[model samples]
Target: MPERAPHGTSPSHPSPEAYAALESLLRASPRGRWFLAEYARRNRTAETEMLLEAIARIERAVLKPAPRQAVPSNV
Candidate 1:
C-alpha cells in the first residue's frame, strides 16, 4: 500500500477503500455490469474474481443488519 499524504489526502493513487466502494456501487447500480466486465477484461485474471468477491460482500453487508447496542437504565 502507498504511504498516506499529509492531511489524509492521496497524492496520486486512490485508496483500497475507495476501490472497494466503487466496485460495490458498480456491481449494484444499473449499467454497471458493463463497466465491471470491461474492467475485468482489461485487468489480469484475478480482477474479475475480486470484483465478484466485492459484489458478494456488498450483498451480504446490505442484507445483514448491524447489532444493536444495549443502554444501561438511569432509573
Candidate 2:
C-alpha cells in the first residue's frame, strides 16, 4: 500500500510558492493562459469573478497603456 501524507498535508496540495510559480508559467503561455481563463469562467464565483476583474484591471493599467502628462496651455 502507498504511504499517506501527514495529517495536515496532502500530496494534492502543493506549497504556495509552487502554486505561484505554476500560475506564473501558465500565465506566460498562450495555451495555458487560455486554459486558466476558461477554467475560471467555468467555475465562476463571486470572489473568483472579483479576482478576475481585479487582474484584468491591473493588466489593462499596466500592460495596455502609456502614461501621459498634461501639456501646459502656454507651451
Best by TM-score: 2
lDDT of 2: 0.90
Global CA lDDT computed for model 1 = 0.84
Each prediction's TM-score against the native? 0.37, 0.44
How close to the true structure is residue 19 of candidate 2, measured as C-alpha lDDT?
96
Q: In candidate 1, what residue range of length 10 has the lowest lDDT sum? A: 2-11
lDDT of 1 at 20: 90
Q: Which ten residues in a row have the lowest lDDT in candidate 2?
A: 40-49
Model 2, 13: alpha-carbon shift in Å?
1.0
Backbone clash pairs for candidate 1 read none
Number of the top-ranking candidate, with lDDT as the measure: 2
lDDT digits (tens) for residues 13-69 of candidate 1: 659999898889988966897888876777866787899999999999999988998
Question: Clashing residue pairs, candidate 2?
Answer: none
lDDT scores for all predictions?
0.84, 0.90
lDDT of 2 by residue, 1-75 (tens): 987988998678779999999999999989999999998877787678889999999988888767699999998
